[model samples]
Every structure is written in structure tokens, then in C-alpha cells.
Target: MIYELNKSHFYKVSHLLTGDLVNIEIKGVVQGYQPGWVFVEHIDHPKTAMIWSKAIDGFYFIGDENNTDFNDYINQFISLDIAPRAKDLGLISFEFSGTSLSWDKTLESVFQNRELHRSKQFTYKYKNIINASIAEIELQNGFEMMEVNVFLLEKKLSNLDFVTSMILDWWDSLDDFFVSGVGFCILYKDQIVSCCISSCVTDDAMGSHTVTLNDYRNHGLAKKLIHQFLTYCRDHGFEPNWDCMEENLGSRLLAESCGYTKDSEYILYHFKLY
Candidate 1:
């Protein structure tokens, strides 16, 4: 039977299952950052008895239900059929099987740069260099650092603030460290202009790392910030990665200009609640 989840219940279960490493939490369940995914707990089932599984393209399932049963759930919820697959790089805790997902080269590049591909001992060196570059650019542009903070999903269902909660949920499932990613913002004349966030995934691996705000467009600020972030990731034994919709030409161009290649593309299925 389909069940409705309240925010508090969702948070309680999601935290019980994924811990503080999760990104998307709302009320109580896991939401998607991209499209075509949902993280939910089977309310009637025991938490410890639950099983989590991930398929291709960030698709995940919770509980001991088999693929056929899960497919039934997907069809019922979204009116679509999906096959399950075994665990892959993006799948953190579970395994299933289906067609492999596709990603472009640029997406791959973003993932690589997400982690700086270095060891922990050198992380500060990388961060200092990147931060210094950002500071230098800010000084040159007369921008001021307004805020620098790290977000930690210590509890459950804290992702309602973002547009892509489900994708964030899936990301949290795979990389526990992303729960504490850092966000940096720069302000001009007391108006927030540029901002970026860094992930905990290694640079060589495929992951999401950076995002810049709008209104600060066309200033090469994103490129500079990303470059510094990448250098930081490299020095700290991590790689850097970034991704945007294929239709986002501006982002594609920026990534390309900054040495990111075109990665493969995967269809994102979105289901809106009535």
C-alpha cells in the first residue's frame, strides 16, 4: 500500500538510515536533487530490517523488496517502468540491475575536479591557494566576502530549501561526507552576488562539487572560483566535478572554457505531485 509521509517521520527514518551524511531531507523522507528518484522508508517495516538498493542513474530503493516489487511501486507512483541494476560507482549502499546510465565528458570532468585527488595532509595547501585566488579576484573586483559556512545534515529531511532535493538525497546516500559541504558567498554593495559550494568526493571520481549564483553571470567569476576549487581539490587528494542540464549552454561553455570536457547525457525523469 502507498503511504503518505509527514516531514517529522521522514526525517526520523531518513536519519536513522543514512546518518548525518545525507543532503536531502524534508519533513522525514529522502528527496531527489535531479529527477526520477525518491527515497522513502517502508513505514510498516522494521528500520534495521530495511534494505537499500541503487540502480543506474541515481535510482535507489529502500527495503527488502525485490526488483519486480520495486518496479511495481515505480509504475504505480510515476506511471513508468524501470529495471533494477547491480551497484555501480554512484550506488553507495545497495545493488540492483538495469541499463547503465549515460553521462557526457563535461559531467565527468566536473566529477574529477570535485575531489582534489590529493591526501588529507595537503588539503590545507589546496584550500589556501584556492581561497587566496578567490580573495585576490574579489579584491581586484572590489567584492567582499559576505559569508563562509559549512552545512551539515545532522538530522533528517533538511533538503526542502533546495530545488533539487531528490538529487541531493541520492548524493547523500552515496557520499556520506557531502553532508558537510562548504558554501562561500561574496557580496557587492551589500548584495549577495557570487557563491560556490564544495563537495567531499574525490576529484577523480564522478560527483557534484560547485554551484555559482545568478546575477553574477558573465563575469568569469564562476570559472575563477571553479579553477581555484579544482586546484584545492587536487592539492588535497581530491578531484573536482560539476554538472548542469545539457540545455544550459552558458554553463556548458564555462565548463568547456575552464578545461572540462563534454560528458555523456542521461535523461532525467521528473514526477510532480498533484
Candidate 2:
């Protein structure tokens, strides 16, 4: 039988998570620095584990994939306990800590009837930045760009809160976000049109979340914002992290343009709920 681990004991499985250090979401949740759930094969000493983050609708599995009992229990738990309630939470996406044919085979078997969708996710590491021409645009009229802070968020000016909330979905509160988070936004007529921010953060790295308004695309706004964000991270000694679906050509191109080199790739399995 599997057991749910108390948040206090979440650290028990940290060693198993070394394979995905760039996944700040995993670090955040596992450390209880963010919200999530954890389950293990053994309450006293776990050999297998599952962690789920509600904010991102993401699940991560780690350790002992060859454990038949744990595998059987998890398959049932996901199908009967989790799958039925997925709609309430959001569509669930599954990722594993390390590459294991055993785990991969188990995933296919467990989700065979659940319409599992698989895709590749690419992670990028910050290298030397490719400086872009943003000063001319920054000097342009009606374009204002600035760092995001408590004061700026507190002002509640012109859809800033909405965009911040939408992009920083992993953060529970603005207070929590500003504790270590950093972001930059470009505004047109006081309206935030393009922004890039630290979606997840740790002592040495910061994950990225970038968005541009639909009508504001193709104007180099995203590039400018990313360049500024990366510059800030570089100056402050934090490595900027980026992850995107392999199919997202635009996002991949943008990251490459900003000097983020592809570091690793992983698979994500999406399960839909009725």
C-alpha cells in the first residue's frame, strides 16, 4: 500500500529528484516552499514517490520504478482517485525524474486507455547573451518598461495584476512572489503588452515565463523583454532557465536568439479528463 507523506517529511525524497534540477517547480513543491502533494511507497522509508503540483497541473514521479507493488498502487490511485477528479484540478501532465525504460513502459501500460498524449519538452541553459537592439525602442514614445516589484503590483495599474497572475500561476500570492521573484514588463499607453518574469526561482537559477499580447506579437517586444530579463539575471549571478515544448518553434527561436542553448529534453504525458 502507498501512503501520503506529510509536508514536513517531503525532504525524504529529495535525493531521487537530482535528475531534474532545472525543474524549479519540483524543487519548490518538494521543499514545501510551494503548494503540492506527495505520496510514497513506504511511510517510514520510501523507495518510490509521486508528487503533484496543483498550480501547474504537473505530476512528477521518482525512484524505484521497478517496484511492482508501488507501480500497481499508483496506477490504481491515478485512475480511480486522481483521474476522476482531474477536471476539477485541471488537465494533468506527467513527468518523471529520470529516464527508465521500466517507468516508461509502466506509463504506457497505465495510461493506455486514458488517451495519454505524449510530447517532448526542451530545457535551455543560459550562455553568453546575444545583445539585441532594444535602446531605440525603449526610447520610443508611449513605450514604458520597468522592473516588477511590490509597489508596481500594489498600484494595480491597467491589467498588470491580471497579466501577472496569469503568467505567474505557480506563485500563490504577490507577497510570496516578491519575496525573491523578479520580472520586467513593457507597457504601451500604460497597458502591459509584453513581459518576462521568473516563473520559478532558486538560489542559483530562475525559470522563465514570458508572454506578449496577441496584437503585440511580431514587434520584437518579447525579444526586448527577454533580453532585459536575462541581463538582470546575468548581472545578479543567477542563471536564467527556460523550458518549452519542442513544437513551439517561436519560443525555441526566441530563446536561441537570447543566447539560451538547449540543455536537455524530456517527455511529458498529458491525460484528459471528462
Candidate 3:
């Protein structure tokens, strides 16, 4: 029988997570600051497990290979528990760690009748900002820099809805964000055009994310915002980590330019429930 692992037993599944963002979400869940679920085949001595982060729609699998019963249970859980809730979310993403990678085919079998897509994700760690001049870079005539805060969220700027949701959805509330996150943005004509923030935070490290309006893409605003982000990291004694799709040249280039070295790579599997 399947069991929903208690928060106190979360450590049993944690041994399988290696990604910074995954770790951050799991930590937040453990601290009651994030929403997630943990399932195991055996409550007291689980040999198979799955950790799901609600905010990110991510699943991390850890288990023995070819465990038909557990895999069957996962398939049922996806169809019943996950599909209804995740229909609004574009894709459900999955990762495997520890000995679970060997179960790739076993896991994929569960989604055999569905459309499955796979992509490589790279994780980066801070080396040193290559462009020391980033901080001194001046914006062109019409652009300005601003700090992101609750006041900005209160303003409800139509242009910033995406950024606002990115913060609130991940942190769940403004109070949690104020306690665990930091952010900055670039404004063009009083509208936010680009932003950088701690997408995930743990005690000693932060996962960085950047978003620039399509129209503002080539203007270097992302780099400037990242410089501010790195500044905050240095001041607060946090190590910065970046994760991006292997196919995203822009994100990969920005990380390389900013002295982030590729630390690891993993695969992300995506599939729709219905």
C-alpha cells in the first residue's frame, strides 16, 4: 500500500535530491513555508519514494528499479490526485536521483500512453563575476533601476503581473517572501522591463532567476539586474546558483558571462495529464 510520508520522515526522501531548487523547495516544505507532498511505498522503511513540490510542479523520484507495484501506484496517483489539480499548469516535470535513474524506463512506462517530452537542465555555481564593471554600467536615457518590495506588489502594476505572480506563487505569501527572498528590477518609462530574484532560497545558498520582457531582451537589463542580485548575495553571505534549460542559449550565456560555472546536469521529463 502507498503512504503519504509525514513531514518528520521527509529526510528519507531528501537523500535523493541534488538540485539546488529542489533542495530549496524541500527545505521550505519542511519548515512549513512551502507546499509539497511526499509519498513512499513503506512508511517505516521506504525503498521507493516520490517528492512533489506544488509551487513548481516538480516531481523527484527515488526508488528501486522495476518496482511494478510502486510504479502502478504512482500512475494511479497521477491520474487521480495530480491531474485534476495540474490541468491548469502547463506541464508536470520529473527528475530522478540516487539509484532511481536506473528506473527511468520503469517510470516512463507509466506515461507510455501519454505525450512525454524530455530536456536537459544544467546547474551552475558562482565562481566570480567576470564583468566587475557590471555594477558600474549605466542605463540608457530612458531606463531606471528599482528594488522590488511589497510596495511594488501593492501597486499592482499591470506590466509587473508576471513578476508579482512569480514571487507570490513560489513563496506563497508576501510575509514569507520578505523573510526569505530578495529581488530587483529595471524600469522603462515607469514600467518594469526586467527582473532578477532569488527563485529559491536555503540557509547558505540561493537559486537565481531572471526575467526580461521580450521587447527588452537584448538591452543588457538582465545582466544589470543580476549584478544587483549578486551584490545582495555577497552582502548577505549566500552562495548563488543558477539553473537553466540546456537549450536556452540566452540564460546559459548570461550565467557564463557572470562567472557561474556549470556544476551539474540533469534531465527533466514533462507530460500533460489530460
Model 3 clash count equals 0
Point out the higher-scoring one by lDDT: 2 or 3. Answer: 2
Q: Candidate 1 regions off by >4 Å?
A: 1-66, 77-141, 145-147, 150-179, 199-215, 271-273
lDDT of 1 by residue, 1-73 (tens): 2343443334334433332112121111233222233333355442311112231243323333332333334
lDDT of each: 0.36, 0.73, 0.71
Give the runs in model 3 whose Cα sits over 4 Å from its true position.
6-12, 15-34, 44-47, 63-72, 88-100, 103-116, 128-135, 154-162
In model 3, what lDDT does residue 122 have? Answer: 81
Deviation from native of the Cα of residue 227 in model 2, angstroms = 1.9
Q: How far off is residue 161 in model 2, in Å?
A: 3.1
lDDT of 2: 0.73
Per-model TM-score versus the true fold:
0.44, 0.85, 0.78
lDDT of 3 by residue, 32-112 (tens): 556677888877777677767777767766656466657778777877776666666655434433223555666567767
Better of 2 and 3 by TM-score: 2
Top candidate on lDDT is: 2
lDDT of 2 by residue, 58-164 (tens): 78777776777687777678767777566565564444433444566777775667767788888898864333222333535677788878666666468876566
Reference-based TM-score, model 2? 0.85
